[model samples]
Target: MRAGHCAPGWNVTSMKDIEHPIPVRIAYVGGGSLNWAPTLMADLAHDTRLDAEVRLYDLDPAAAERNARMGGRYAEVSNGTPARYRAVPSPREALEGADVVVVSILPGRFDDMAQDIGIPARYGIPQAVGDTVGPGGFVRAMRAIPMLAEIARAIGEHAPNAWVCNLTNPMSVLTGALHAAFPGIRAWGECHEVTKIRRQVAGIANADAGSDRWSFRDVEVNVLGINHFTFVDAISLGGRDMLPAYRAFAAANASGVNETVPGEDAEHDRYFGSKCLVKFDLYDRFGIPGAAGDRHLAEFLPVGDYLADPGRWGFGLTPVEYRTRDQARRRARAEALAAGEIAPVAKRSDEALIDQIVALAGGGTFVSNVNLPNRGQLAGIPEGAIVETNALFSGLGITPLVAGHLPEGLHDIIADHAARQSALLQAVMAGEGGALFPLFHEDPLVRHMPETEARRMFGEMIAATSAWLPENLKGAA
Candidate 1:
């Protein structure tokens, strides 16, 4: 099995002579040289049932090539799956014939984020936060929506059958844009957050990591509202109520190793510890931990609660800052690898749970946290509005679970947030700049401020994001 470009007419029938017959062609956009794509490819290649060919595209051709080489090396050393890699600067070229198009692009990356935060802070709006909340999320959505629309258009034109797995922030907005714009396209946003949360719960429950004790299988957890503002309405294990144990864990500050995640760093620290304040609050009131935390939680809480005191809660860096710092560190490390001063990060082979869903989709069983039309998935949400919940996938197709009526309190809060976010996505898709003001005004962090101040901060943040936002938004700013 050769690596790199493949000759034409290498049909599955001809390939069957070798061993594995059906090759799953995956196209990845952005973070091509990052760990996820290569690691995922390596895992897929090892499966005797999968013949995986990865076509990686990025704005930076060199980065794409580097990623492809590393991915090729991973396949060769590990499973010896006939893996082929390509670096196409053109998104259309990379997207052609892709069974799955994985999107992880950050349009302006972090430099633009710094401006979104710094400029707003200058106006005394005090936004150490960005990404999931505030004017920053609005601006970020504006910049990203167009690109995602373009990606969706490309998929529709070039590979109508491809499943788009979006791994971008503001996941709800982007996924909603795709759903609204290309109704025929099969797309869903992917986030590791829910999986991480499930693992945390298992740890809190003192379930063994090695067994099915805490496996996500058959565990019913309801996530509502937008991406980051989601809350767990119900969680049950083996038809037994588990919310009591989860609430106890949240309240008691139980310290147990999280069995699902594989690291112990600042990321893990924040994951396990930092969001306790909100979880504590939610448990006391709602009897369960809020699925979204930190900036996400701040965005959903009443504005008064968020604006009361940043000192006591401590403001944190925005998503752009966090992502930028991480990327810079990764680039610095990659530079060492390029100079042969450091060995390439050793590739690991762990099957992504998402990939399992994809495999199931191919085989006819599709289970995931999909962002798609409500169509009665949740009793209270608008029928066509996007809702994230457990979905059953089989050969027939994807079926989102209809979450029966939620608790009235939770339903009201989630419905409010969902309406705001859905409107934001619609505004972006329509390129309506004025709609941004309302979205910002609706945000929990800004709702408490006077109308004049809220508008002023919104204007200021838009100005800061001028460099990255769409031309219409720039003009509005």
Candidate 2:
């Protein structure tokens, strides 16, 4: 078969075919992102396979311009070809006739994010990484959903055929809001949590973490549930069932190997300390392997216990200083690249976004976890709710692989939360102030507290973020 040819659900194409590939037009919604923008540029450069015309759009025009210049320099200095890069002023200009749209925006900066974390802390709710779930996610949804809705409307008007790929945090909520705003829009959320879990599972099989020692193409793992709180029910390696061995390893931490993920170098000293223990604990207690980092997993636990001793869960309150330092590092790297003092490096990333685009646009098949509307892939979760599950991307379109059922306890937990997320989106969209309180009340962290306390906390958070929130939600307290 030819490079762009595939057999129904099977895709057997090689990189050699990508030598002279079709050109894909990509529009980046938050192109100024210092954190993700550079890595994405490097990935596109290394692919060297598929050609692309890239449009950079950002609220900060200067940042987008800098990225465009950086990409141009990278293309000039690199050994292989990269996408054609340009910075456009408006989202409409960027989205016009584009093939794919990538969204990676921080709706508000660190000061706003600080309110998402800090205000909730006053009410005795402690969040390790407040970007995803809990009080932090709820308030963030308030500020981000409206902005994302506008972006979705623009995509609908300017580039209806474009595939919307969101890499924003509060992953499930943000992605859900997009679909809620623009139903029938082709979209999905890409997260690195499952990829990290896959690497750890691969390490357990004695497979090289960074190599194709065991190809991802040869393995099948049933990943289901919400983003960051996902669970893997089964894993098959090379047509052999490795679930038992994996389960044993999870129960015993038998690998005894440091997973060595990014941002984990500071805690590299502890044996099982640097590693993920809460995930293993979930597998032992719930019979479903936890698939995200412990930092994320800790969010779903009761607030008081985690607040009492966060170190037990392998995380701490992520200070704003960390964000400041990260921004400085990105700025320094950009300055060095522009000054021609340091050469641009092109390396393949574990991020499957590029692979997904190539597979969908180039007529190949790629299997990976994606967040999309649930259409029977996971049992017990509402059918239309956005879910994270194993999906096959190809010319046939993105198809979810059916994951039969989650353990009853885990299913109940996920189903309840998924439903709440769905309801929360609706309430936020409709500006229904009364409906918002119960959603926060039901949150895993705040649920243990009295309804009055939850209400007070919700009101305080809303007030703290009044400058960015909707009129109905701003002072609903």
Candidate 3:
């Protein structure tokens, strides 16, 4: 992290030798994204170790070029090392000789996302974040899978050996789609939800036990289940068990109302904020800690808990109108940064993208939680279904650690999601959109509704989002 230091890795010396310098090429899909692109551009500017040439590809060439200009501004403004950034027109051109590919894209317009949430709301379903689960996530997956598969095919044709790290929501299904389209592709999905949990656990343990030299990075866990619904069975710090302290903390806070998190500002208009009230509530029920935020966890549970009236709970539901307005705000910010009218932020994200890439490049072995095919890493989840677990990343290849099983109380809820994701994947790949009703009807929010009403809502949702859906999927129900 220091100036002039090589990126943190093992067994590498003089990675930045001026003579005969080794080049690291990274392909960034969805490079036009204002949400993630700026974060990556800033993170890359400070990472002196991997001075990569990042070629960006996006559906909108103009947005991508704007981001490229922002990256150039980073190089001009920073006193530290900065990665080179450029915009390319096609996926193949961006990925032709890349060492790693990062994916974070919006599947459809914000208008389509509005339908994804609004139609479900009319049917009495509650969703805190619609893109991860509920009826919204199911339909969103239908639109996202095929597009992700096309990107997968390009990676196969161009950079077959590249390691892929998908950051898209509906992450499990889309990561599976990548492998399904290209069986030989090395792909995994990364999320920071678990990182949030680890930080919370470290704080609680330190307060209770007066722990010896512990930080979020020192907290070790055995991760299980899939993305957004992930759980941790065991946690330790400095080889000492911290579950007892966590149990006491959960017991005290499980039955209370939380309006603000410990470190976040309460006065700001927060679209994504939580105080872990829902996570503690789940812990009280299943005796296992939920790793994702309360808002994301609420969507996977029964409607009454967190979503029926979201504002009454700690985490409020993010409205579509707010998101629509925020797009223009983000665009304005992007324009200012791109034009050098404002200085770009240089702080790095806590995300694991750069660490994963460095490890995959034979820099060293790095272990972290990754969403991969279930090859016995998670028991009871079907094989080849994308599941999140601890894995070792090294020059040898990705080797998933055996993460045991889901608790019996949570077995049905987690396993059924895995099954539904598989069914959705098959339906999308075959373009059999009408075949999805059975799974759609059985989703948690829809199962309790009258059969006729559920079907009607399903049809209306399809009709509403048809602008971005393919012909085969448009109102096929």
Candidate 4:
């Protein structure tokens, strides 16, 4: 609602727009996605520039229908000429001749994710957000790769020219699999982990961090490493290096001591959580500012009981209860919207997917963290292995910036995982399900435990998830 925020269908006329309104067809692969679909719908409703159509497809018909209704309702209410939204039953129907394809699907059920987190915990290898790295990350890739390959093939046949912007978990691996599956597809993984960190940095420097409500355009940064495990190697504000100031703040807050006013404890303090004490610890050790939150960074840290009690690393476990609560909240929201008690609220969001699409279509430029093949952007990682780094998106294509080299200490950790990630992708694509076990053998957490125990736990997890595992992996054990 605020001025300067990208409005639904931003009508600003560029040379391209002046010539004729571009017809954009976006296919939402997981159109029933409870979290991401709605926000994207709202963004589309706010934009006034393009003549757009959004086709929603999902495994759950009712979920997709709900989103289609909500999306259409938002467009009707926003009073802006928004993208027409419709629910379709199949990927082929959704993806046919689309200009941009947004993939954000959960390959399996929520129960499977619970098993991913819980099975690892039984062995004392704790994971906070297990979708990205560690045993959970590898196993998740096993389940997700096949589904993604299917989507890639669908796109190749139906929307071959559409730009694929994946917002899925195990981002690097999933996105990498899509690239490998369809070598000619233009695809990249989009994540908000690094974006949130950028906002936090802006707050620390007293600089403007752009928001959906308020636009604060200029913020420059340099990033490196794989997803979940990334770092802000350089940050500048108005041509001034802000790293020293940011580091100074981190150093001062290293102890994470709370100074509360009489009777008011830290738990009652709303602003206490902003200081990332664990990341600062990493800064001291690795000499670069950590990009992700402590919860994600905890998975890769070489410390004891850090996974079991993430509190040991200054964070808490992401229990299954959290997901239960989230599901309940989503159901309630859906019900309320259906009953007309709540109308869709239209506002700009910080997500960069739509912005990237608009930029690519309108000949504008968009810069954000994108996951793609390394290709010398990171000297430490393999050339074609997926790596998350800063890049510029334009009509021509996404050009990853030269991030040079990661620090040797950090490089050693990322390189090890990157190699394993490559092996996991190869194994899954080749249907060599048994080969996945050795990749687990090299896992940092599994490496800490006894080999026999680790193998047993790994096999147990594989067996537990057999229902959803690809045909190749289903009977491997």
Q: Highest lDDT: which candidate?
A: 3
Instruction: State the C-alpha lDDT per candidate.
Output: 0.62, 0.76, 0.80, 0.75
Residue clash pairs of candidate 3: 7-49
User: Residue 204 lDDT in model 1?
Assistant: 48
lDDT of 4 by residue, 1-477 (tens): 111122221122132343444678999999988879887877777765566799999999888888887777777766356668899988999999899999999867778888888898888777777787777877888889998998999999998999999999898889988998998899999876665456655566563344443222344567788888888777765556778877877777776532222233454232223336667777888899888767677677653635555444456556666666666787678656645679887776767776678767865666777899988888868889999887776687887777768887889999998898888888999999778887877887778777788888888778878877878887554
Measured by TM-score, how close is model 1 to the native structure? 0.83
Better of 1 and 4 by lDDT: 4
In model 2, how large is the Cα lDDT of residue 254?
A: 35
Of candidates 3 and 2, the better by lDDT = 3
Root-mean-square deviation (CA) per prediction: 7.5, 3.8, 4.6, 5.6
* Residue pairs in clash, model 1: 364-394, 364-395, 365-393, 365-394, 366-393, 377-403
Per-residue alpha-carbon lDDT of candidate 3 for residues 1-477, written as tens digits (9 for 90 to 100) = 111111232112223333322368989999998888887777777665566788989999999999999889887755355678899999988999998898889999888888889988887896877997789998899889889999999999999998898999899999999999999999999888888677877777677668644557667777888889888888776557778877787777755434343443543236677767788878878889888888888888778767887665677777888887777888999999999899986666767676567666666666678899999889998899999988877767787878888888787899998898888898888888778888888877778888889889989988877776788888567
The candidate with the higher TM-score, 3 or 4, is 3
Q: Write the per-residue lDDT of candidate 1 for residues 1-477, one digit (tens) a residue.
A: 110011111101111223444567778888355646655655655545556677888888888877776665555544445567777878888888888788878757577777666665665455535665566666787888888888888888888888777777677778877877788988776655555455566554555345545554334466655577666666655546677877666656633322323554666344233434554565566654666554456655664565345434533434455666667776665555445565433343333433443444453243445666677777788766667765554444565665466566777877876787788888877778876787777776667778888777777667666766677777553
Clash numbers, per candidate: 6, 0, 1, 11
Question: TM-score for model 4?
Answer: 0.89
* Between candidates 3 and 4, the lDDT winner: 3
* Candidate 2 structure lDDT: 0.76
Encode model 2's per-residue lDDT on 204-319: one tens digit a residue: 66643555576434455678789889888777665466788777776576333344555444633231123566677677779887888776777876775444576665545666
